[model samples]
Target chain A: MASKKDPRTPAQIKLAKQLGAAIAEARKKAGLSQDELAYRCGLHRAYMGFVEQGRYSITVATLVQVCSELDAKPSEILDEIGH
Target chain B: MASKKDPRTPAQIKLAKQLGAAIAEARKKAGLSQDELAYRCGLHRAYMGFVEQGRYSITVATLVQVCSELDAKPSEILDEIGH
Candidate 1:
């Protein structure tokens, strides 16, 4: 049986972290804590923490939720990456 | 054990489909087939099909891969979602 292991590449991991940092900065600028933002976005606090820490591979849908709660545009958040 | 069902909302599903359509448009404009794009991105063709069909909740990393293959930006693809 072939094992299916899709480990993220280093570049992918770095990108995730960059995205997380961007989200954290936006959340702070909006005066929201991780838990508070998570609650407002209907996400689990721990999951939100993971998202902020760049430990989770976030979906576009989830990104929209977070961006909505932060009152920030998706482009604003993504623009922070690769910069 | 508590069930951990994180079903996507209708809005999320719609957004995913929109994103998918945007990707398909970009890919076509770039003159790349789904399989060719998938091959370049190291993704399965079947999975690429699902992504084009907007049937999958794509992760940011995967989105980056597809965008890279399409020579497009994340913002460009996302901009098509809510319009």
Candidate 2:
């Protein structure tokens, strides 16, 4: 498991947080709770919570799963981060 | 280290390949070789090649590092995949 305090630069951390917020916003827009979304993505509810909190370094595969479940394009979520 | 054959869905794999191609294209547009870009991002050259080849799952932190070095936004790369 990756540590909560992974070795990311400040800019990277900022981007991760922004990305997390975007994901959370999208999930809300799609009218899915964290648990429901996690179930749809086949991810653990706790893991999904961590992701939304920006507490871990998220993998591209996981991102795709989450986005697919939310009926969102990965680019759309990323676009909200402005980077 | 993640395996080359990670258990990603077909859609995820396709998106990964597209993202990799976009990264490679952006790197070229910035006139940076894999070696140069990897050095800038503090990643191994072979690892960078794997990323470009979409042979492994990439982390958001790594994406940020690469995009920063390439003068790109994460959304731009994901956008090229149209998702």
Candidate 3:
């Protein structure tokens, strides 16, 4: 369960999910598995799965690495609603 | 040292610092101490110090909590460059 009264609203969750969808699409476009991307990003494979599932709340550092591994920009990941 | 090649860039770091400053300012405006904010935010006091010092990378969860403790919003914390 997430902390209630936190900054992430339903809107933010929706946005995060949208961002995760974008990341999954990008990873597919680049022909990379979740494990491959996680390795490239220097994160745990399970963490990558959580990211894809929108189960984990991420930091800017994680965001940068994931996007870098996927050859993405933060804006790019966020620009499209669902990819 | 933090993770190299991490998502946090000089720009993102700048933004975070600015955000931290905004949070500190808001806390002051609300007349709360570091300990008080930390307690209300459910974070460690030392962690709050690191956040204020811009030495720690934070998660969205943490962001939500800190901002909430300050009676602030994500946009409010970020919209002001420094205040």
Candidate 4:
């Protein structure tokens, strides 16, 4: 239910995009599709897509759940991204 | 405005605590008190304490903002914590 017009700053938006890409990369490496990952994380498929597109703000809990499903550490993906 | 009874999973809760500690450490290293850091991040001081206590769920934007103020990268703090 997040709108594109949400008030995230430019830096935050950049971080989101970078983080999203990293998650998507991890999911791919784990041989999982967006829908599959979403199902595993108990997140909606649409929400997963939105997350990958950086159109949504991800909470810490959601990030952990996604990483657990992908056999990835949140830091693995996060560290790969530039601050 | 978050409660200890938040519906986060145990894993999420652990991650939150680890993350909170890392942030608190960063703030200390920056020589900033919780109130000072919260003021810099435009967050309420009480909310900052909750975040430090892992009693609140942090969004990506908030994490980035906190990191920016602390001269810490999200990944730096996240990677230092055990998954």
Candidate 5:
């Protein structure tokens, strides 16, 4: 394995879950299946699931792609958590 | 690497750079050196540099931490990109 960073801290994971919840809400509103959204974003469906579960630290670019697909703004999602 | 994902696409990189630029601008306005910001975020100076250069896909938690240290809202930074 290559060099890896430390695991996400609990606080970080809590924030990530908030983000994931926002994304999930947006995706559901957009009526796209998680797999469909992942396909559109050129990501694996499993990866998308992990993102939704707050199990992964999604990149900014990926967030854009996901938000774009859902017609949701990243700011809107960030706003959900008062970020 | 273990089950690595693909490298960022050109479009993704462009978007990343834009995000990075906004963050850099905010960091500068906050009067914090890159190294100082990195220290506060518990990240390596080199990683922070890459983030500023749009070479890294920063996680949401890290972004929040960085923005918190800058006293800038993540919403404000995403607003810079119309995200």
Candidate 6:
């Protein structure tokens, strides 16, 4: 179990938070509803919501699909998230 | 648009693919149904499936949530995925 106090490090955790928020923002910018994004990416609406909330770690495949749906790339997403 | 001829570098893509698979494997190992994991991590279940398939790029916040659900750290997840 990760320690509640900075479970990991602040830098990584901060990076993750920003990244998650960026993805959510990007998804919205793309005019994608959670379900729409999910459908396009072959993801579940619930999972898409989870991702938006930054409550789960994601796989590369998921990232790719999300990017594809957004018409973006990993680098662009990463840049948005400041990572 | 990313070129189909190695949209990204093969190494990065490969690393992403492996990382995606590792996350899926870890999610399963944690005895977490995608929905259950999503619930625990405050995620959407559909995104979980997308992640499992390595179809998308994930945010750090999402990564943290997923890792928390799996009782793992980012390093561990990265290590598992060979990134």
Candidate 5 similarity to native, TM-score? 0.88
Candidate 5 has which clashing residue pairs, if any?
A: none
lDDT by residue (tens digit), candidate 2, B1-83 = 86456676787778678778889999999999999999998889999998899877798778867888888988767766776
**Candidate 5, chain B, TM-score (2 decimals):** 0.88
Which pairs of residues clash in candidate 2, taking residues 3 or more apart in a chain or in different chains?
none
TM-score of each: 0.89, 0.86, 0.55, 0.88, 0.88, 0.46
Superior by DockQ: candidate 1 or candidate 4: 4
> Model 1, which residues run further than 4 Å from truth?
A1-6, B1-6
Question: Which parts of model 6 have CA positions greater than 4 angstroms off?
Answer: A1-12, B1-83
True lDDT of residue B48, candidate 4? 95
State the lDDT of candidate 6 residue by residue for B1-83, as single tens digits. Answer: 87456455565466656666877788788887888987887667887777766655665556656777787666556644533
User: In model 4, which runs have C-alpha deviations exceeding 4 angstroms?
Assistant: A1-4, B1-4
Report DockQ per prediction, comma-separated: 0.45, 0.67, 0.18, 0.66, 0.68, 0.14
Calculate candidate 3's fnat: 0.29
Measured over the true interface residues after superposition, the C-alpha RMSD of each candidate is: 2.2, 1.7, 6.3, 1.7, 1.0, 7.3
Number of the top lDDT candidate? 5
Clashing pairs in 3: A7-B64, A64-B7
Question: Model 1: per-residue lDDT, tens digit, B1-83?
Answer: 99666487889889888988899999999999999999999899999998988889999888888998888988767865752
Residues A1-83 of candidate 6: C-alpha lDDT, one tens digit per residue? 87456454565556656656877888888887788888987678898787777656665556655777787775556644543
TM-score of 4: 0.88
Kindly provide the TM-score of model 1 when superposed on the true structure, using C-alpha atoms: 0.89
Residue-wise C-alpha lDDT for candidate 5, range B2-81, written one tens digit per residue: 86664878888788799899999999999999999999988999999999999888877788889999999988788788
Q: For all candidates, what are the clash counts?
A: 0, 0, 2, 0, 0, 28
lDDT of 4 by residue, B1-83 (tens): 76447687787778788889889999999999999999999999999998999888898678878999999988667778865
> Candidate 3: misplaced stretches above 4 Å?
A1-49, A61-83, B1-9, B81-83
